[model samples]
Target chain A: MIENFKKRFQKDGIWVLFLLPALLIYLVFMAAPLLDSMRLSLYTGKGYTPTEFVGLQNYIDLFTNPVWRERFLGALKNTVIFFAIHMIVQNSLGLFFANLLSQDFKGRNFFRTIIFAPATLSVLVTGFLWTLILNPHWGAINQTLKAIGLDSWAKPWLGDENLALVTISLASVWQWVGMPTVLFLAGLLGISDEILEAARVDGASSWHIFWKIKFPLLKPVVGVVAILTFVDNFNAFDVIYAMAGAKGEPGYSTDLLATFFYRTGIAGEHPIGIPNMGMGAAIATITFVILMTGVLIWLYSSRKNEDLV
Target chain B: MSRTQKLFTYSALSIWAFVAIFPIWTLIVNSFKPQKEIFSNPFGLPQNFTLEGYKAVWLKGNFGTYFLNTIYVTVISLALIIFFGSLAAYALAKWNSKSSTALYVFFIAGLMIPIRLGTIDLVRLMQFLNLQDTIWSLIPVYVAMGMPISIFILTAFVKNLPREMFDAAKVDGASEWRIYLQIVVPLLRPAIATVAIFNMMKIWNDFWFPLVFIRAEESRTVALGVSLLFGQYRTDWTRALSTLSLAAIPILILYILLSREFIKGLTAGAVKG
Candidate 1:
């Protein structure tokens, strides 16, 4: 057995040379920091370095401390709303667009390219552009509304407290709808031509076939798209930072958990203007937990779905 | 399909097409107009065109430096990711061992758990290494962030390769490196393209790392530059729009030229998973 092991090692030892660079880099930069950040969360201090170890205190403060609690809860609420908008609006629009593109049609490639062009641009650029376009006075949307004699419909998109989060979410949806569209389109196109032909031969209407057949077939892609959307939205930062400022301005209505983490951990909350590294790490740890929960749930449900199939 | 169904499809698509294009059109077109003209005629096709915005951004701002900095970082990071990623993936594919399998799972886990959560610690690491304010800071983080997806895609591709080729090369006394160069790489071109395009988009468009690590104008990326420009030129609509347009036009042109590959590359994960 020892000889056999030695032989295997002698033969495949080149694998070590192949694996070391990536493994070393991954361990040092990614895996180490991720775990160490959790360790750092137990400590609290000012500026970039947290020297004091106060176990569970930062987490407690995040939950119960008045100043921290309001911002924490507000960011949490807005993040969920941001996530919900993507799940409903973004994914629905993606599915609709994908279904439309699935059928044979004219200018199909042109429409596909047009729909996806925005996704190539930076989120920062899109956020800033939309903020300009959605401006209350001379921006395109409001001006066009006024031009069409719907003057009363013109309102501040990024300026109002209640509207800011939703507006930003929609702008993000606009940028990324291509992801799900392409994913869903791939799935739709994978449906066998024979099955679609059979449906047509059975005298089923196009609407009936799309709903009863194509939509059901798209369940797996839907799962993947929703999970991707959930993960992306929770981690979203650039949009709010660009459009509403890093503070998630307008009374912090647009504040998502990521921007909250940025404010608390990296940039430091204003006035005192010192980063609370421990609290930041704690926020990250919580975001980590949330992401893991979501992914595990998705995995379990998808596996169960496969078993049923 | 019926005539009404065709009309419905075309019109519905047209409305969304309009929604998608209008903002981008205004962004590009209005960048050419004078400052006040932008606000005065927000949606029009620049009746009085000028290169003033572009000139200001290019000549005065550090826009050119930022563009070059972004290109340098993106190219170097992508090269490292592909090099390290492909090597690791090839071994994991060929080395039938419990440890190899475990390592594959370890890397793949990163796909779900974002590398952003590790930012605070990474910042500390960067400072410790004296890289906090330089372009070098972003390289390791992006390469590390990119590893999981690259390995995930490339490993799956490698696994399906004909096993007999490796055995044949082995019998012929070809060293593993030679075999990898002469054999695996030739076939891995398309998959490499897939991996390259996938990570290219993320690294090029990324704002978070540059935001966290770099502060100096010489080291700032395009995304960072745009954010700073927005703040500086907030009241100057033409310059602001021009900055955005300058940063965006290259990507738009690239997407149009390589739409098929871009679409395939961006959505490669869906197919792979």
Candidate 2:
């Protein structure tokens, strides 16, 4: 066995050498930090200095303490609402647009390029740009509304607590709708022409064809899109941070897990509270688990459905 | 395919397209106007097109430095990610060992994991390595962040290639390194382009890492620099708009020039995965 192992190692040593650079970097920088962060969650501390090894105390506080629990639950609720908004509004609109673009129309490429253009720009630019447009006084959105005799519809979209979360969600949807649209378009193109032709020969309308044929065939892509949206929305921070600041302000109405984790971990001091690194690490670990659970559920369920098919 | 349906499609598309472009159009148009004109005639054509806002951003805001720092980080990170990602992918694709499957699964699992969750320890590690507040700090992090997807894509690409090509090369007495560098690397162009475009967008627009990792002004990326600008000059719409345009326009131009490839690459990643 020792001689056999030696021979195998000699033969495959060069292949191992090829994998070394990427594996080393990934293990050290990505994988190691993930494990360390989870470990850090076990200890309670003021900052980076953990004073005590309180096992799962931080996680308990995350659920029990009034301030921590309130923020944690609020962030979780908001994160769900954020994901729901994307899944409902963004993905639906993306499908609609993709269906429209899939038609043989003039200027289809132009329209596709224009719609996807915003997704390419930095979130900082998009966030700030929308902030200006949604500005109450002289911004174009309000001004346009006033000019069109619908001044009552205009309000401080990003500032009012009741509307802030929805407004931010819509802004994110606007920027990222292109992602699903393109993915869905690719899926639509992948549907076999023969299947569509048979449906057409049977006198199926476009809407009927889409509902019965295209939508069902697009199930796998839809699963991919939903899971991607789930991960991205849960991990989202930049747009909210840029538009509403670190506090997810207008009273934490727009706080998601990512922003909440940032404020709790890094900001350390604020008017509302002080940062606890242990609590922050705990939040991070929770976010990680939630994301992993989501992806795994999607994977297993999709696989099971595939087996059924 | 009827006239009414075509018109309806065009109208619907036109409206949504307008919604998509309007904010960016407003930013670009307003950036050219003076502050007074922006407030007075917000949507009007710029009566006086000036470079003053761009001038302030370029000269006063030190955006030029931020731009260069971003380019430096992005280029170095892409080079390392492509080289190492393709190499690792080649091994996983061609090697038929039990460990290869384990290694492939290990790397592919990074796809679902958000690297931002590990930011706490990353800061500590950076401090330990004395890489804090330097461009070098972001290089390894970006490369690591990008690896799982790059390797996944490249491995699929490498697997689909004619196996006999590699065997022929091996029989010709070419070293493994030679086979990878000369034979595999050139054939992986399509996958490489896909990986490059995806990584470029992520790295170039990434705001979180730069916000957390780098503190010095000189080390700041353009995205971070633009955010800082937004914080400081929130009310100064003229300069703020210009700064945003400066940050966004280059990538916009790149996307327009390579829209077909970018779309193909992104959709390929989604469909294949």
Native contacts matched by each model: 0.81, 0.86
* TM-score result, candidate 1: 0.98
Going through the candidates in order, their DockQ values are: 0.83, 0.87
| Tens-digit lDDT track of model 2 for A185-237 | 99998888899989889999999999999999999999999999999999899
Tell me how far the alpha carbon of residue B100 in candidate 2 is from the true structure, in angstroms, after superposition.
0.7
Write the residue-wise lDDT of candidate 1 on A1-309 in tens digits: 999989987877899889999999999999999999999999998888699999999999989999899999999999999999999999999999999998898889999999888998999999999988888987888988999999998999888998899999999999998889999999999999899999999998888999999998889988989888888889999999999998998999999999999989998888887888899999999999999999999999999999999
Off by over 4 Å in 2: A271-275
TM-score of each: 0.98, 0.98
Candidate 2 chain B: 10-residue stretch with minimal lDDT:
B229-238
lDDT of 1 by residue, B181-254 (tens): 89998989988999999999999999999999999979999999999888888888999999999989999999
